[model samples]
Target: MINDKVLSIILGGGQGSRLYPLTEARSKPAVPIAGKYRLVDIPISNCINSDIKRMFVLTQFNSASLNKHISNTFHFSFFSSAFVDVLAAEQTISSDKWFQGTADAVRQSMHHFLAHDFEYALILSGDQLYQMDFNQMIKKHEEANAEISIATYPVNAKDATSFGILKTNEENVITSFIEKPKADLLPDWTSEVSEEMKGEGRNYLASMGIYIFNRDLLIKLMDNPDTVDFGKEIIPQSIHEHKTVSFQYEGYWTDIGNIDSFFEANLGLTDDIPKFNLYDQKQRIYTHARILPTSKISGTTLNKAVIGDGCIIHAAKIERSVIGIRSRIGKESVVINTYMMGSDNYESLAEIDKKKINILMGIGERCHIKNAIIDRNCRIGDDVKINGGKHLEDKETDTYCIKEGIVVIKKGAVIPKGTII
Candidate 1:
C-alpha cells in the first residue's frame, strides 16, 4: 500500500560513554539486552516488523563485535534485493575524517543511499527500544508530502526539558523546535489539541529522534558543509524555511542510554503486561538462536526471574533477576535484581562446609566472586569472596554503584582469588 521507496539507516556508531563498563569492549548497539538479545536488536526488530528490509548499520567505536553479531544473526538471501549491511568508516573521495555527528554519518554513507535509489531515508538510533509500524509513518509522510517527517511522542512537561520538543500547528505542521528547553521557557501546546484534551496542560511533543527525509532533501542537507547534525542544526533550520510534518506516535518507546535505564528496560520485559513483547508470534524477534540444550533447573528456588538457555540453577535462590545464557548458579547461592551474561560453556561449583557454606560466585567458569559484577571471561579461584558491592563509597570510578551497595565490575577485567574489590 505504500509507494515511497525507503532506505533505513541506523546510527549504531556512538561510543556509549554513558554505559561505561558495559561499553568498554563492545559498542553500545552490541551490548546484551534482556539477557539474550543485543541493544541493536530492538531497532532491527522494529524495522523487520514494519516491513522495512533494506538496512545499513553505521559503526565506528568498537565495531568488531557488533559487525560479527549482525553478520551471524541477520542474513538475507541473494534472491532478495533487500539486505542489511554494516557500514564502517573508510577513506572516501570527500574526506578522511571520522563521523562527527548523526548527519555527518549519513553524509559519509551517501554512496549506500545512492546505490539503493531510495526516495526517502529513514534514520533511527540503534540503542532505542520500541515497537512502531514505520510503514504507517511512511504512509502518513507520503500523504503529507512534506520535505521532512519526524516521529513525535508526548512527554510530561516536567520531562520535556530532557528532549528536543517541537511545536506544531493545527495541520500537524511543525512550527518550531527547541532542544532541552528550560522549565520556565518551555513552549505551550494547548491550542494544538482538542478542547477536552487541553486540560492535559500543554504537554510537550518531543522528538523520538526518528526521522523520514526526502532523499533529495537529505542529499542537499548533507551536502551543506555547515550542517553538522540533524537535531542540533539541520532540523532547526528546516523548520524555519521548509515544510515539515509531525507524526505523533503513541506506543512504548525507551532510550536505553545509561545503566539505570538499561536495567530498568530489562526489568520491563518481566512485567505482567510488558510494553515490549519479544514472543509475538506474528512479529517474531529474530536472533542467532544458540544451539544449546534446554536449561536444567533442578532443586532451584527461582522467584520472579528470567533464566536463559543451557543454564543450570542447582538449588540456588534467584529473585527479581536476569540470568544470562549458559550461566550456572551454585548450590545455595543467592542472586537478586542483577543482570548476568555468560557463555554457553560456563560452569560453577559451590563448596559447602559444616559451619558456613562457601559461595563460589562468578561470571565464567572457575571464577569466584560475590557482591560484584564479574566481567566476561574472568577466572576466579575457590574460597575467594569478591566484595564488589560491599564497600559503599562514591569513589571516582567509571561504573554504576547500585543502591544495594554492590560494586560493578568493568567488562574484560580479571579478579584474582581471595581478592575483595
Candidate 2:
C-alpha cells in the first residue's frame, strides 16, 4: 500500500474544439462518456481506487458544467484530511492572463500546492481513459529516488509521431525526449536486440502525459522561464538537468481527444475482455450512481450494446450502441452504432433511421431527432427531420460542415416539430 502524501492535480481546462456540439456548452472533462459517466470521472475514480483522496481539478473553458459535475459527484467528508475540489482560473499576483499551457496552469495554481504539505504531485489529463494502479508508479518513484517520474507506454513507430516519445537506458533513466518525431527520426528499439529477436517491430516508448513530480523539483522547474509544457518544454529540458525516470505501463490508456478516438473508446467498453473494465468488483470504478431504477428495456432488440440504468427502451432496435442513464428510447426507433445520454426521452411514435443516426437524441417525449447531435435538454419537436447528408455548409449558423452531415440541435433550444433542415 502506498502512503497518502501525494496530491493529484487533474488538468480539465481544454476547450475540446474537436468535439464541437457536445463540448459547446461544457468543458472537455465535463463531456459525458460511456453513456452514464463524464470524462473527468475516470481519473477521479482512479484516484479513489488508488487511495489518494486529496485532489484538485483545474479548469478554464466552459467550466460551469465541469464545476457542477465535480461538486455533485465528489463529496467527501470535510472533517477528514482528504478532499476533492475544483480550481478555476483566478487573478494571481503573477499574472491576470488565462493559462497559456499545461505547465502555466500548474504555475498559476502553485499557491494551492504550496498550502498543502505533499511530497509528490501527480499531474494527469482529465480527458484520457485508463485503469491504472498509480500506487505502483508512486512506489517506483520513491524507489528510484528521482526528481520526476513519467508513465510511458510502448507504441508502434508509425503511431509514435503523435506522441512525445522518450529514450531511456536500462536503468529507466530518461536520456532524451522528443515530441511527435517524424517517421525517419523514430528510433528502432529492436535494433539493439539479437538477430533472433530482430523481426518486424515498431516498438517505441512514448509518454502518456501522466507525471509524478517531486514537490520541490516541480516548483523549481516551474520557476524556470523556458518551461512551458510538461511534454513540449519541461521534460525535454529536464532530461539535460534533472534525474527524470520513466515507468513503463503495459496497461490500457487512451486519449479521447477526437470524435473517432472517442467513438473507439466507447466501443471498447463492449468488448468481452475489455482492457478497461469498469465492472470489476475488486477495483470498482466509482461514479455518482443515479438514484434511479434499472433500465426498462421492453419491446427493444438490443444486440451488442451497453445500456445504462433507468433507460426505458420501448420498441426500439438498439444495436451496437451505448445508452446513458434515464434516457428513454421510443417505439420503432432504430439506434445503431450510436451513443445517447441522459435527461432525454424519445417519442413513442417516432421512427428513427439507423444508418443515418450518429449521436442523436431527443430532450423529452415529444422531441424528434435524426442524424444529429441534440445537445442536453434540447426540446426537439415531433416529426422534425434534421436531414442533410454528412457535409452540408451551414453558413446561416456559422458552423462548419460535419463530415457525416450531422445537424446539431443546441441545448435548451426548442426546435419545432415537422421542421425540415
Candidate 3:
C-alpha cells in the first residue's frame, strides 16, 4: 500500500541537444509521443497509477510547454492531498547557478523537496517509456532496509556494454557499479554472479536509472558539492558507504536519448503487437484531453496507423505512421514509416485560399514522405519528396535534418514545392 510518506522527483532533462529541433521550442519532456501524449506524461501517470501522487518535475530547459501541459492535464480532487507540481530551475539567494547535472538539479531543488513531509524519495527520468508499479519497488526497499534501491534490468552480453553494469551479492545488495564498460571487461565482472541471480538467461544487470532513496540519505548524498551526476559521481561512490540494493525488473523499457531511438520507439508503437502497449486500460497514460472533432478522411488507405483528433484527410495513403492532432493531409499524399506531429491550430481551406499565410498548415497535395518525422505546424508544399538515399549520412539544413537516414522536417518550417532529399 502507498502512503503519503513518499515524494517523487522526475528529472526533466536539459537543452536535450540530442533531440535537437524537436526540442527547439520546448523541453524534452514536452516533446510529444504516441501522437497524443507528452514524454513527461509517462512518468507522472506511472506515479498516479502506483498511488504515489506527491510529485515534482524538475526542468531547466525550455519549460513553457511542459508547464502548460502539466497544469492542464493533472487535477486531483479537492478532497484529496494528491498533487503534481513543477519545479523549474530558478536563481535563488543560496544558489545563483543553473542545474549543473542530474544530481545537481536535485540538489538545487532540495529546498523545495525538504519543505514537504516525506520519508522516501523516488527519482525517475522524464524521457523513458515503461510502466512500473513503484509500490512493489517501495516494498522491496522496505524489506531490504536499504538506504538506496536501484531498479535494474537484465541484458544480454551484446547489449551490456552500452549501460552501467551492476554486480550484487546473493541478497541483491549492489556490491559494485561500472558505467559503460567495454565488452571484454563485462564477462569477468558478470561471471561472478550466481545462476539464480541471472534470471531470464541474461548475464548482466544494467541500471535503469530509477532509484528509491531514503529521504535523509538522498539529502546527505546530495550535500556533497562535487557529486554532480548520480551515475558518474554519486551512485558509484555511495555503493560502499550506503546500504544500496538492486531490484531486478522484467519489462519493456526504452530511453529516448537520441533521434534514432526516438524515431524507432514511435514507429514501434504501430506494430501488430507493440512491445509497449499504450492501450492498456489498467495503466493508462494520461494527457491533456483536447476537445476536438473526430478525424475525417475520404477514400484514404491507412495500414496500422494511429491518427489523433481533428485531422482532415483527403485521399492520402498513410501506412505505419502516428499522426498527431489537428493534421491536414491534402489529396494524393503518401506518408509511410513516419511520425507526423500535426499542427497546434487549424487553418481552414478558406484561410489558405485567401493567402492569409504563404504556406498551408499541413501536408500539401502529391507529397511523398517516407521514413521521416514531420514536426508540429510544418508547411510542406506539393510534389515534395523526403525519402533519403539507401546509405545513411549525418546531414543538416535550414528546412530539414537527416540523422541516421531519418529525415526530420523542422518545426514550423516552410518547405517550398518540388523539393527533394
Candidate 4:
C-alpha cells in the first residue's frame, strides 16, 4: 500500500518565550498564522491530505485556546476512525513532572498512542509553516527499510547555525549528526545538494525537525527516560545504532522559532507569488469554519495586501499587509508591513453608541502603523502612530511590547488617542 496506517504526534513547543506576545495568552500551536489558521493546522492538514487522519497534538502550557480551536475546527465522521485530539500534559503515577523536552512529551503520551494500531510514527513540530504531502516521505521510509527517517532541508552557512545538521552516506543513509554547528565548522559540513541549491549557496542539510520512526523502535526508545530532546540527544544517539534515512525536502519550509522569523514569514505572504503556497487545491491548509460575512471595504487602496472575511476596512492605503478575519481599519489610516490579527467577534454599534465607547476594536481613524503586529481585538484610539524599527529599544508594557524592533500590541489591549510609539 502506498499509504499505511500511521499516527501523527505534533509536539507543541515549550513556554514559547521566543514568539512571546503572540504566544502570551495561548500555546504555540494555537497561535494564529497567515491570517486564519493556527500553527498546528499545518501538520494536521498534511496528515489528513495524505490519508493518515489519526493524530494527537501534545501540549502543556496554555492549552485552553488550543483545545478550543481543535474542538471547534476538526470534525470527523463517527463511522470513521479519523480523529484529531489535543493531548495536554497530565500527572500520572509513574511521572508527575511537566514535559521537560520534546521526546519526554511523547514518552509521557505513549500510552495513548499505543492504543491505536499503526506501523509508523510521524512526528512533527507545531510551530512551522509549510504544505507537504507526508505520504512521499513515508514511501521512502518503507522502501529504504529504515528504522528512522528525518526530513532534511538544505540551508546556507548562516541558517545552518540555527538547525541541527545531518550527514548522509552515498545511499542517503544518515551517518552522523550535529546540533547547531558553528559557522567555522560549516566548511567540513557541506553535503551533496541540487545544483539550484548549490547556486544559492545552500549546501548543508539541516534537520527540519520532522521525523518518521518505526512503531517498534519508537516504543523501545521511549523506555529510556534520559533522552529529553530529539535534536539534542535522541537523533544523534539513534543514527549510529539504527538505520536512518534522510528525506530531502526542497520547498518553502520555515521554522517559526522567534519573532523576527515569524514576522518575516507572515509578511512574505504579500509577495507577488509567495514561496509558501496557500492557494494549492490538493494541499489545503484547513482551519476553523467560521460563519462570517464578506469583508466590506470603502475608499481603501490595497496594494499587495491580503484581507480576510468580514473586515470593514476604510483605510486610505494598506500596503503589504495581512488583514485577518473580522478586522476593522478606520478612515484615512495607513498600514504598511504589518500583520493585523482580526478580532474574535464583532462589537455591535448599539453597544458602542449607548456606552459611548472610548476606543474601538481595530485601527482608529487617521492612524499610521508600520512594521508591527496588532494582536486580536486590540482597540487603538484615533491619531495613533506606531512606527516599529531598530530605533526603539525593546520593552514591554501592559498594552503592548517591542521585540526585535517589532511592536506587538497585546491581545485585547486598548491604546488611548494621540498615543505615539
* lDDT of candidates 1 onward, in order: 0.73, 0.74, 0.89, 0.93
- For residues 41-89, could you state the per-residue lDDT of candidate 4 as single tens digits? 9998888889988889999999999999999999988888888999999
Residue 112 of model 1 has an lDDT of 72
Q: What are the per-residue Cα lDDT tens digits for candidate 2 across 1-421?
A: 3346899999985678777667877898988888778999999889888989888998888999778777778887757777778888888777798887899899989888899889999999999999888899999988998889999877776778898888888788888887888888875431132232234353677789999999988889878755667788888888879889988886678988876577668767866777788877757666675687888877767677888887777735666667777676556656555555666444333445544432235433323344444445554445444554445664335322243455655555665545656
User: What does candidate 3's lDDT look like per residue over 1-421, in tens digits?
Assistant: 3469799999998899999889989999999998889999999999988999989999988999999999999998888878888989899998999899999999999998998899899999999999998999999999999999999988878778888999998899999999999977976657334465466557788899999989988888888888899888888999999999998887889889998899989999999999998889878899997899999999899998999999998847999999999998889999999999998898777887788776688898999999999999999988898895447587888878888888989999999988987
Candidate 3 all-Cα RMSD: 2.0
Which model, 2 or 4, shows the larger lDDT? 4
Per lDDT, the best of the predicted structures is 4
lDDT value, residue 139 of candidate 3: 96
By summed lDDT, the worst window of 10 consecutive residues in model 3 runs over 191-200
Off by more than 4 A, model 2: 188-202, 344-374, 379-410, 413-421
Question: C-alpha displacement of 39 in model 1, angstroms?
Answer: 0.9
Regions more than 4 Å wrong, model 3? 191-201, 353-355, 389-392
Q: How would the candidate models be sorted by lDDT, starting from the highest? A: 4, 3, 2, 1
Model 4, position 182: C-alpha lDDT score: 86
Please give the RMSD to the true structure for each candidate, in Å: 4.9, 5.5, 2.0, 1.2
Residue 109 error, candidate 1, Å = 1.0
Task: After superposing candidate 4 on the true structure, give the runs of residues whose Cα lies further than 4 Å from its correct spot.
Answer: 1-4
Listed in order, each prediction's TM-score against the native is 0.87, 0.86, 0.95, 0.98
Better of 2 and 4 by TM-score: 4
